[model samples]
Target: MHDHARGLSSGAHRRPLAVSLALTAAVFAVQVAGAILTGSLALLADAAHMMTDAAALVVALFASTVAARPADERRTYGYQRAEVLGALVNGVVLIVLCVWIAVEAVGRLSAEAEAEIAGGWMLAVAAAGLVANLVAAWLLRHAQKQSMNVRGAYLEVLGDLLGSVAVIVASAVILLTGWTRADAIASLAIAVFIVPRAIGLLREVFSVLAESAPRGTAVADIRAHILGAPGVRDVHDVHVWQLTRGAPVFTAHVVVDREVLDGGGAAALLTNLQECLADHFDVAHSTFQFEAVGHEDRHNAHR
Candidate 1:
C-alpha cells in the first residue's frame, strides 16, 4: 500500500514540475525581452524571479528521481536525503537571487532613473505569469501535503505568483503616476518576500542533514518509555534521529534483569520491549543492547 501511494505521488509530482519548468522558461524569455525593450526594472525583476522558478522546478524533478532509488549497501538509508539536499540548493539559489535583485533595485533607486515603461505589455505579461503560476500551484498543492520536497517546490511557485502580482501593481502605478520609483520599489518587495523564506528553508534542511532529533520526539520521553518496560533495569546511551522526513530510528543500551537472560528468556523480553516502543513512541527502528544485572561494569569497561 505504501509503495503504491509513493508511486502515485511520484507520478503526480513529475507531470506538474515538467509543465511548470516549460512554462517558466517561456515566461522568463518573454519577460526578459519586455525588460530590455522598455528598460523596466519591474519587468526585469519578474524575469529574474521566473528564472529561479525554472531552476527550482528542475531541481525538484531531479531530486524526486533520485529519491526514488532503492536502498543499497553504499547508501543503506536510501536516497531520501537527496530531496533535502535539493531543497537546500534551491533555498540558497533563491537567497542569492534575492540579493542580486536588491542590489539592482538599490542602484536604480540611487539613480532615480525613469524607465520607458510599457504599461500594457507589463500588465499582460504579469497577468499571464499570475495565471500560469496559480495553475502550477494548484497542481502541486495536493502532492505537497504528502512530501516536504514537493512542498518546497510549491512554495517557490507561490512566491513567483506573488512576484507577478507585485509587477502588475508596479506597472499600473508607473503608468498612472509616472513614478518610475514604483518599479524599483516592487523589485525590493520581491526581494523582501524571497529572502526570509529561503533562509527558513535552509535552516530546516540543515537541521535534517545534521541528524537532529525528529521534531516532537524528545529524548527524555523516549528514555522514560524504554526504562518503564518490564524487565528493563536501566537505559543509557540513547540516541534518536530521523531516517527521512517522516521515518525515525532509535538505538540504546538497555540493562535487563539477570534472570531474563537465563533460560533463553531474553529474546522474548527484547521482542516485547520492541513492540512497546513501536506502539507507544512511533519509533520504526530500534537497537537494544541487552545486559545482565552483574555485567554492567564489564560492559562499561569494554565500551
Candidate 2:
C-alpha cells in the first residue's frame, strides 16, 4: 500500500510539471504576439507575467525531478531541499517582474501614452488568453494540492489569469470610452496584485531554507506533549522543522524517571512518546533519546 501510494504521488507530480511547462510555453507565444499587435500596456504586462509563468514552470519541473533523487552520503536529507530553493528563486523573479511592471506603469500613467489599440483584435486575443489561463489553472489545481512547488507554479498561473482578465477589461474600456489611461490603470492593478503574492511566497521559501519550524507547529507545544507522556521526567533539546512541504521532523532528549530507566520500560515509554507526538502533532519523523538520571554528560555528547 505504501509503495502504491508513493508511485501514485510521483506520477501525479510529474504530470503537472509537464502540463505546466507546455501551457506556459503556448501562453507566452500568444502573449508576445498580442503585445506586438495591440500596443497595450495591459497586454505587455500580461506578457511579462507569462514570461515568469514559463520560468516558474521550468523551475518547478526541475525541482520535482531533483526532489525524487535518493539520499546520499553527502546529502543526508536527499535533494528535497531543491524544491524550496526553486520556490525561492521563482519568488525573487516574480518580485523583480512586479517591480519592473510597476515602474513602467507609473511612467506610462504620468505621460499617458495613447494606446493604438485594435479594439476587436485586442479583445479577441485577451479572451483567448483568459481561456488558456483558466485551463492551465484547472490542470494544475490537483497537483498543487500534492506539493508546495506545484502550488507556487499554480499561483503564478492564477496571477496570469487575473492579468488576462485585466487586459480584457482594459480593451473594452478603450473601445467604449477611447481612454488610453485605462490600459495603464489595468497594468498598475496587475502589478499590485502580483507583488504581495510574490513577497508572501518569498517569505515562506525563506523560512523553509532557514530551517525554521513549520508554520502552525509550535516547539513549546511539542515539548509539553512529550513531557506529558507517562514515565517521562523531563524533556529538553527539542527541535522541530519541516523536512518538506508537509513532512515534519522532530528530535529531542527525554529524561525518564530512575525506575523506568533501569527496567527496560524506557523503550516502551519512548514508543509511547513517539505515538503521542504523531497523534497530536502530525510529526512522522521523530527521534527520541532516552536518558537515565545523571547522564547529562553522555546526553550532551550525543547531542
User: Compared with the true structure, what per-residue lDDT tens digits does model 1 show for residues 29-121?
Assistant: 888888887777877888888888888888888988888777799997677777788788788888888989999989888984465677778
Give me the runs in candidate 1 sitting further than 4 Å from their true place. Answer: 1-12, 145-148, 258-284, 296-303
lDDT of 2: 0.78
- Angstrom error of the Cα, residue 115, model 1: value is 1.4
Q: Which candidate wins on TM-score? A: 2
Model 2 TM-score, 2 decimals:
0.90
Q: Which pairs of residues have clashing backbones in candidate 2?
A: none
Best by lDDT: 2
Q: What is the C-alpha lDDT of each candidate?
A: 0.77, 0.78
